[model samples]
Target: MKHNRKLNIFLIIIIIVSIIPLTSCIKDNVQPISKTEYMLGTICTITVYDNKPESVIDKAFARIKEIENKMSVNKPGTELDAVADAAGKNFVKVSKDTFYVLKKGKYYSEQSSGAFDITVGPLVKLWGIGTDNARLPSQSEIDEKKSLINYKDLLLDEKDSKVMLKRQGMSLDLGGIAKGYSADEAARILKENGVKHAIVNLGGNILAINTNTNGKPWNIGVQDPFKTRGDPAGGLNVTNKTVVTSGIYERYFEKNGKKYHHILNPFTGYPMDNNLASVTLVTDVSIDADAMTKNIFYLGVDKGMDYVNKKNGLQAIFITKDKKVYVTDGLKGNFQITNSSFKLMDKK
Candidate 1:
């Protein structure tokens, strides 16, 4: 989905804060600096707390660069590009990392009953809603693409670490979950590198490792789907968790006075028109949370909440187009609603 508000401003703020020094020690004569940057089509903010020399920060950046090289679609030989190229062709043997991501995609597809599909790539390419070449495809075009879109059609050979699309013209787009996966991977690398406290923000997918240097939960703001530009719509305080959101207001194109968003429903081959404006999921696993946000958005408010409530260790915040907010029972104590425009709905 296309963000109605200009995201450049928010990106700037994230970039600036990511580079500033996180802490300084007065007694030990130590200076701890945190380095961060925006890469891989998402903002990655890495904050490390350590008295180690600048080499640690350099290694962190080096790891991030490695991830960017491996996972980026822009890079010709990357695994993502390989998947894109192998679309409609033979099975593509991917790296273990890529296989793990596809495995999570398939898992969520089953969990959400096909609401979140990686095989919706054909439809996404057809609509081109988020790109400069955005347009509404004809019914026949949508139908043809829909025939090629199904997660069940994706065949995974675990032993060989290969991915195959059952039919011709089928493709896989990891856009929905790649950011979160990268964040999780980056955080894992930091932890392995002896960085205990860190935050990885890949745009809407925010993941925290351990806690902040202050021993407090990391504060994450949920971008208001309807709020005017430059206003805070309140946020959630989370510790060692992942918060990912999928909203119709993110990216889209307008045609015939109607908005066509980037988030396509695999069932309808079009953007979801449910009452929900956005869906945010909180979980220990950012990959699952990322996939679930898109799934819940497509599932609509009622079924989405039902799905979250049924799943253990999952909490969600739902915002309807009419400005109504609903929080699952699991989130009752975890999140605080600060927007007067939002009203909490009681579970039935």
Candidate 2:
């Protein structure tokens, strides 16, 4: 009788143990804290999942704002403006953050073979893309500005943490890479604060932290170049990764029925006519993905494919002007084409 009683008690204990996990999962719920602000020349969104409190999200945004204040070329009295003001004549000492970004900019400039030059600010101002003043530049004006666009002239001093532009008219614009660096910084801050699941979107550059509460990959949509905002050409299943896209559709102006995009070729001082509509990069590093979109888009498909194929852990999705999506072999299963209007090409 005692043996049977003990057996029944053991069975009850087993049942109790089985129910505990479900109850714990129900209790350990995730609350998403999201905040949006107008900064970095675009909308910045930071979302964090925490069961304890919502204060970490604020810190993350503050970090982003701090970066914007230091690096924004449009903002007067900024570190970038300081360097511009001191161009050719003097060296300007900047914050370590500024120095770091400038150094990375130089690295990408060399890697992309000047296809993505931070020193293209002169051209940017002359063309004035992404602003109310945007207009087509005269050939003479384009030629003059092209003379000022040289990444080789940007001198960075590691010893003194200073930067000097060799020419007086030269300017630095971190618009291409700063957003990604800010996103990565925000992620670092969140992780340091013990937050695991979060999403950081600076303008359209996205960094998905870890995974969702159920430990599933976060689905990020690739914007449709033909359609309006929020329309997805396809979807990328990502977790703990950064997804960045550079498309002609992002910033452009219509003039005489011709569209002029912001991504200019440093050689010609005009919008690049690479035939590809958009290039999307996916990687663990946000800054790398951010800068690569511009570089690879400038290279177009053939050279860009050759460049990306040699790199490790880097995947690309190229949407051509003919409504075709070319994905790298590594992203075969992870990328899904949702828009029927676009057809997926065979993997290269």
Candidate 3:
């Protein structure tokens, strides 16, 4: 009996030693996670999950700060500030990133038939719709600025990597697409740092990399156009997709019962008076999604649908002045209309 007991004890020791290595290996192979949030003009959040240390989060935040410093028009002495200063003078040489963005803006301008123009800086500055100095500009002032608002004046030398505005008083404003570009850049940096799962939210431009912990799609809310801020319209569920919305309610000025929004029509040199109250676009590319939202908002329903249908892998939901919701066929199963007063109308 003593020898049998000894043999049983020896077997138990072997089993215990065998489990020790497996436990240690599991612990050593555990993934590291870090989340950082900073309020830069807009709320910016970067979440990183990998085997990297906490310092990686700081590096990522630093990269975001670099981009913001270069791109922010609100910041004095930035690259954007230089461009703004050169508004009516010689063309300013910008960073390659800025050049590339301006090229994309020009392409979108042509594609959207001038609906998406980066050269509307003059009008944007004039109206100051979102600022405390918001007001209506004179007809003569509007007409004069409209003359210089053509995107054709934007000269791009691809081989030399330079951008120039052919005419004086022409300016480039990336307000419509800068956040998306920044988010994409941030994602690239995180991926380079061995981050496989993350989300970068630069204000409304949200970019999700890889699947969530549960391997499910990210639930991104498209802000309700008619509803007040902080309310989601039951939103849409997106997977490997970017959702962006441009709405009149986002930035505007109301005077004498007249509402003037920040989104200006390049043709009329005034805020768009179309039936569209807001436009939300979903696509795989945040930059494209950002540009399309503005284009669709200005194009209104018929032309907007045509543009969306021509492009593959793009979907949109448009809210009209009457609170009517119109969505592309691709979004039939994904987008839900929450406002009862907002009826879903089929495009003919």
- lDDT tens digits, residues 219-251, model 2? 777878764334678888777889888887667
Question: By descending TM-score, how would the candidates be arranged?
Answer: 2, 1, 3
Model 2 CA deviation exceeding 4 Å by range? 1-28
Worst lDDT window (10 residues) for model 3? 17-26
Cα lDDT of all candidates, in order?
0.72, 0.81, 0.70
Alpha carbon lDDT of residue 214, candidate 3? 51
Name every residue pair that clashes in candidate 2. none
Quote the positional error of residue 342 for candidate 1 in Å: 2.4
TM-score per prediction, in order, is 0.85, 0.90, 0.82
Candidate 1: where are CA atoms >4 Å away? 1-36, 49-77, 80-89, 227-231
Ranking by lDDT: 2, 1, 3
Per-residue CA lDDT of model 3 for 163-202, tens digit only, reads 6776666766778887777777777788788777666666
> lDDT at 282 for candidate 2?
86
**Superposing all C-alpha atoms, what RMSD in Å does each candidate have to the true structure?**
3.9, 14.3, 15.6
